[model samples]
Target: MQEGCIEWKLDEKENINSLEELARHGARVMLRIALNDEIKEFMEKGETLRDEEGRRLVYRNGYHREREIQTGIGPIKVKQPRVDSRKAEVKFNSKILPKYMRRTESIDAFIPILYLNGVSTGDFSEVMEGLLGKGKGVSANTVVRLKAEWEKEYAEWRKRDLSAKRYCYIWADGIYLKHRDEEDEKSCILVVIGVNENGDKEFLAIDSGIRESALSWKEVLLGLRERGMEEPKLAIGDGGMGFWSALREVYPQTREQRCWVHKTANVLNQLPKKLHPMAKKMLQEIYLSPDKAQAERGIGRFVNVFEDKYPKAVKSLTKDAEELLTFYDFPAAHFQHIRTTNPIESSFSTIRLRTKKMRNCGNRKTTLAMLYKLSQQVEKGWRKLRGFKEIPYVLEGMPYLDGSRMENAVV
Candidate 1:
């Protein structure tokens, strides 16, 4: 406790001020050792302090380049040792290395792993092993453990405070995750995303199976309701069987917008490969028309023009015509944002690629964990995407939505 004197003790001791003193207090008797470089340097410069024995001594300063070579013991201050004039030797000893140094073989040794966009643990390991030196830091276990934490963090993130109604629009779309079932086969996992009132996004739900059944979608919607999302003013998604049914059951008043992009893809799929160019042009004319009426007119003309050669394409188009054009009645300015589920698709594309590497998810928990982590990671860096700002004016054009309230309901 004296000034300039080293005080040492174990971390539990809570009183030690120096490593040397701590070692001294331990069960094993050990001398506190230190090289006072400055004192040694002064001594090398012909400096001497009289000792009890009164012997002339020289202490040479040692350093690893610019770094000071430091070692010490509790302030008992033993006489400095003399070095052999013929042979000079210096040994380096580290008091303590980072804890990560101990578990070098385990993947978890890599702490505070930099989670990057479009980067995977496998890819990161490859970069460390192939590009950088492999044995320098953590082992395989460290990497797996870090990934497991990410997955766990993601699960916790999904359950975070969603009780408040800040989201103006809740767009729900299912991305099909490639998975395998009981027989060790391939299957699909449906992952849902929600755009909050502030235009921020989050994972709404996740489920697995080949079919996105009504029951499955219903459960997802109900879960959202239970999680504090009472109802959204608008629920936009690609029209799937149980998807709409779930919406109706959960929020009958929610406005629906069918993804125009999916409809276009389906329509294009129905056309022959050679006619894709022509079909694309026709589809564009309908989608990009000046206004809702004009777009509708364009579709009518498209069907008439292609009826003979591509009857099936036109039929397919007709089936999804209303849903595809759902955004039309909303507001012309909002068309860009509501036209398609492309925003959700962008997320799906990344999810598909990440999960695609795995042959099959080990279990439902594992699958959900990965999706939750991946989605949360992506959302963290997401910016508020610009949508149709002019749509408010268009909404004013529709007298019904523009009205003070729809109070005619008997219920």
Candidate 2:
């Protein structure tokens, strides 16, 4: 073995304690080598970069005095590499490990998520201390400060310009979150999500609204317009009267498509509890039909069976008949995507639980800000729309008939 080097065999067996020891040993070894590499690249300027003495300007001096730094796995002792520069104005600093950083950034990041996920503030100190070491836990006051920053971030995001924004399609919905008190339950958050020409989906708005009313929805739509959001090619949402009314006023050119999932749920609500299983199947057949004509026929079958005894259900199903089948006029690859507002619904399924946990935690503005921050986190995981290649065709006003692109046909 080399006098100043270490090696290991992967086939060696070890216990948990030994494994942790091995991890600590590995951290020290890697840090030493990485620091040395940083110095090697700093010595040159140009082809004739060296001094007349033909010597490189920046050279390694030695390791800084060792210090124990805190990490997720536990504290590890490290010695940063030192650089002696002939150029007095230039000095090297380790971005990987700053001079005063006693703890890893991961520890700081983990604390807030822990607190927000139902860990009470009082218990935060003990929980973090156990993981990062004694005296390292952040105070509850610190958490409060972090939360204030959260509010400011969400406020700034609300006013961002959208002058260059355009979406092929959008999904709008009003989500009612339950609170500890009944009065708080009356208010709902209105969400608008749009997919740009690149097919990347993004949140356009998340504002507290008065139960999806026309006036409330008008503000969101107007805000999007004020920020220069262009009219989407189509908008998919439930049979919300307020949203449709607002859409007409702001972007009448954008066609409407009713969410089949919500419409089916509404139709079943009007039927007998005993008939739900049967009626639901009938409703599915309508939207799941292979083509617009077949889907309309399926709707006919449903109305014929229920109209005599269930006039209300029949009306509910037939009222939005045209909008419900609008997906057929777009790319068949997007039929499942456009037939419903599942993009918004699926993205928010997790937020509903967080909202429930946060019941009575704060007032309307604060609550919304927290939701905005959390949603921004959730937004990171959203995937692009399926069949994104067809987005250009959608934006160009290419005609579609029963999910087939009719390129040569007239509008």
Candidate 3:
């Protein structure tokens, strides 16, 4: 060691601490110092401390409260200082640890993600315990309480007023979940998503149904009507869904578009495996065409190529020919969104993966609440559709010819 330089040595018995632990300890010390400084400033300004003529300002009462604040490292217990006011009304509130805040917002948000990923409510404590040390994690009772709050939120959301709401487009589908018990059949949950005039996607409805039957769908549509949801300009869905018949009965004027993705899969299912490659390409031509005439020509070529050898496949493709081609009449920029119910499909894909892992969700109410919570989480990532600005024209019943603006068309 040099004369001016200091020497370093390792302590034999001192506990080695990780960087995260040091950072957390530093934050705790700073927080306490900050709160004490706030109290000091109040005390200095107080009339009692200054011996002024006016009534006493805020003064130190005592440290009467203790709270555990959740941080990245773990939950930290802190003593909250109290204050007494004489003339000026004042309250001691630490910006670092807000009143009644058990966990940070980021930590609170993580709970639903864990729940949606198949972590049961009762097991949250175990999961958190692994992340945080023992005794410093969210309790199962807390998770159950949060779930009850979500149930109330979902109930309130379902009954909200939609009288002034109008959607430019709608997508309908029925999601089937595994049977609860061996004796019971699987259940269907009908879902509807809508695109408002601003082209924002919204989860409109999620209801229990019986295998997408006409009556089941009718009840859902009737509910929407009773809730004051105006008939959307166009509805997109799989042709096989019972939604079509019910939609026609409820909102007869609304145009329909069969989802090309569903149509492609249905057509491919009927064809031989060897023909799938060629058949899929042929189906793509019909949907990806530039205009209705081009699409029709593509369909004609498909029919000519497979009508004899694979009548079932060709029939499946041609059955919803008009509905499949409905996208060509809409704005070219919005054709991608209008051609399929992919938005709804993508969102439900998360639910499908979650439910598959869980095998069977609890009861109908519990299942709906979980689904609603999952949708709320998924909706955060949903981007606005392309050509969103053109939605207002669609809502005004503006017609388009070959994906071009048709001037002065009658509404």
Candidate 4:
């Protein structure tokens, strides 16, 4: 054995512990090494010990320290350790322990934690510190700590989930926000949510666009089909010609359900503030009517009552009456779910609120990664939302679903 060097056998745990003890036996080595903020994080988190595969090895709490000195034989080899895991915690706090600390093995603890609080990065940091603090490896700048893993995961996620599968219904729309990428131009984010056979909604894809153009929406929808989505039974969206064109290009047979909420918003925008209540009442009669015939009658009543005073509003309402009530054709049971794209809208609100803190995205990939992380958060707590329970009953006369028919339907 060299006088000032340490070596160990791979099979000897006792020797390893003894070596650790020897390193920390005397004066504590408190050498500070410069590292990128991220590497420093690994030291801070007690995640410094990693396997050859780069996966973190838990329960090993030792960090490497290096020193150079002029010795009899030039620069002598020196490696020392200060504080390691063998030291018992001098103190403990029951109230300070983070709940997420227990799930150390999970690679995705951040998602569920952030989702619970309904906050973005800054808020996410505050909530974590508020609950857990520094002891559990919680940091104020968590996104910086998570950059490497997030990048890797985002890349893998983009390439992994590919399938040319069909959906029963897909809700598609865009959320606009001001992102100061190169300049503070209005940017639109495209989101698509697919409804599967069991009436479960799954997020399919999201993309950013300068303007909600036909070209951009078409690219997004085309990318979806290219990734895995096949023909859809229906595609619900705001009645943008671009959205319709994109849907048509992707799934020729899919039914189009113009978002009722957006159309109503357009109607209400034209009315004066005081007249909104009356306008809403008139619009409700059209939308709430049980059948197309009754809805038409309601529309007639609305026009007769408001046309002279609010010709523009009446004309807009009458123009969109058919598209607004398309949900009625798809069985009364499915009406509530299909009338608007509220599910996707709610999901967007979370993402927007989270990212809006930053003036601009770091880059396109980071923007996408943030959105993906937020979506994963939503999915973590998501329950299978109950759809039209009477769907089977509503379609009773339709040929009974045999095994082959059912298989074909899903495919």
Candidate 5:
């Protein structure tokens, strides 16, 4: 029985080894074929030989050197075709394998995504060594270089023009990251996302702040204004955050909506554990109602049911009552987006997952840069909000009556 088990283990090891070898061999063949095809196309197009004045310059020079490129499958050897052109200096550069490129750009881009997916910098070498072979591991230096590049990218993204664009709605939130140096220290990252006139969501600002304080939020909002970001029609955020206070001071014209998710959680926290499920259902009724009138009825029922026993919970619900139902005034199609700050939540889910595992994310600059890069990656998959076509009407100040355009509304 022991002999059979040993044989099974050996067979499994052999199979895994063979699969990796096969992948490397296949990649080599594909790369060689592609390079050969590029040469053939170049020669056929008369690109190898150019006529300068009356002198003909020939660029067809034999293969200069053989190089090995590290790929996910392992290192694949490639022969670089060189050109010795007289009169006109021309070089044969393969689009498949660029000059001095040891690794593919796709591999470079994937490294950061992997880092943001909860793979720590120290674990990168081990993780990559498993996927790629022994010496092909991603070094710490490479990660540092990538972080530097990402910092430059973040800087450029922050300075982009917002004067030409207008947002219909914005979601604001502050996320805290624990510092490694100090156990008691936590840094707050204030983030804002805007839905444009086209109903497309965009990441607007990500700045380091002081625990979502009114001053911190005001600095962020003022920065947006300085960058030429027009005042959005509505802003959604947690009821307890200082964002509302800052918004009132910066752009009072922008209406406010308290996130139903945050409000529900706050109310539930104040109530008894057993009352949570029923209390949550009652709160949902208020947000999910067809119109403001029905929503108000739902709110009244909740207040009446909890006021006597859970007066504090009832107070939590009624304190932001007007803000909670502000979405009803907007087009019905947009209510789902306006009712909550899910857009910000969804984008930061990756950052939260990664940072929680990290516990202490270096310094404030590094933390903000990491969060910005992670958010940028997440923004790629974000879908346009539903009922996007109505954005123009919203921007035009047309009144929406119970989620529909008001009758005989003037342009």
Candidate 6:
């Protein structure tokens, strides 16, 4: 083949920008078809809705009103057809478009993502207008109403029954938002994510911290118990979370596992900057050991090396020694998955970023609702736990040695 000037294929008549307009038109047409079909089915071939006696029951009234429905593509003007029935109890209602709906459910969902992205309520119209169309976006008041709706959803989710659920692992975290005025020093959101027996992760709880941390965490655990959540097999969190105390009180049988990542950070914070790299590597060695016995040995090594110079760092390292090594008691394959609260952190990374940029989350209800909405969306993308098959053995309380069942261990 000889090199030559290339000619690209392009259709001069086909304007890509017009595709949206064509789609909008198509949506309107389809909406009419569906509405008409609903009416035809309601009235049937009888010309007017009637009973077997041929008595008139329903007749087309008229369009309720022409209104604009905000959608992801753009706003489309729609006319919801109406009908009146001879029976006072009968009426025509469009399932396709409810009487009070002004926007698509997708639009309702999109607003919160924007809100989480640090878009203020006042900025919603301008931002949506640019994404939607100049004259087709929702108002700030609409955003306010959506907030009320989300609060209701959060309220309902908080009260949901969890009695039939059993989780193999649960991760807990307390997230403190940076506020505008730095109002409450203790304000934080306590989040819990659980891994069910099927190895699927799900949100178990998201509650705003109440008063004393021990009491607040206790309340969260007690709430889970009340809602029928059986005690999880393992609970992973940072050592400092008052969650451990609450866990002991609420589910005494559940095992505790301190996050190695948080543990490393806590220990390093006590050591000199010059020694951080070495100290961190030693901490990693302890947690990354092949088995519990070696892990305990690694801890002893870490202590012997640093106890004289960095007693504080060694103290932090040894204080939660048992919890840090708890991952070894489970299947080897699950060590990576359960050793840290990374699952929880990664899930809320976006929300944390947005919430950090926001000076004030308004109120506890608003903040919780906003976080809940984002999590609801985030949960859809979660993958089943790795080594999910090993969950059954753990649930059965079988003894694990070096990440293998005792029976499966070599002689």
> Higher-TM-score candidate among 2 and 4?
2
What TM-score number comes out for model 2? Answer: 0.77
Q: Which segments of candidate 1 are over 4 A away from where they belong?
A: 1-127, 136-138, 180-184, 351-363, 387-411
Across 67-110, the per-residue lDDT of candidate 2 in tens digits comes to 88878877788877777777777677777788878767666556
Residue-wise C-alpha lDDT for candidate 6, range 111-186, written one tens digit per residue = 8767755677898889898989886667999889989999999999999998776789999998876433345533
Residue 254 displacement in candidate 5 (angstroms): 0.7
Task: Candidate 2: give the clashing pairs.
Answer: none
TM-score of every model versus the real structure = 0.61, 0.77, 0.77, 0.62, 0.78, 0.76
By TM-score, the best candidate is 5
Model 5 ranges with Cα > 4 A deviation? 1-123, 181-184, 357-359
lDDT of 4 by residue, 94-136 (tens): 2212222222223244543343233445555455544433333
Candidate 1 lDDT, tens digit per residue, 1-411? 789865544557346666655553541212223334433454564445434576544434343222211122212212333332211332222322211233222122222222322344455555454422343433457657756776777566656666874444556666555433465244445666665645556666655544666787788777777788756656678768778887899878777877777877888888888888987888888888766678788889988888998898898888877767666555444567667776667865754665566454444555556555556556766766354343233323322222122335332
Best by lDDT: 6
The alpha-carbon lDDT assigned to residue 284 of candidate 3 equals 89
Off by over 4 Å in 4: 1-128, 134-137, 140-142, 159-165, 183-185, 350-362, 388-411
Better candidate by TM-score, 1 or 6: 6
Clashes of each: 23, 0, 0, 3, 1, 1
**CA lDDT, every prediction?**
0.56, 0.80, 0.80, 0.59, 0.80, 0.82
lDDT of 3 by residue, 250-280 (tens): 9999999999999999999988899899989
Model 5, poorest ten-residue lDDT window? Answer: 5-14
Q: Report each candidate's C-alpha RMSD, comma-separated, in the order given.
A: 17.1, 5.4, 7.0, 15.5, 7.3, 7.3
Q: Cα deviation in Å at residue 375, candidate 1? A: 1.4
Output the TM-score of candidate 3.
0.77
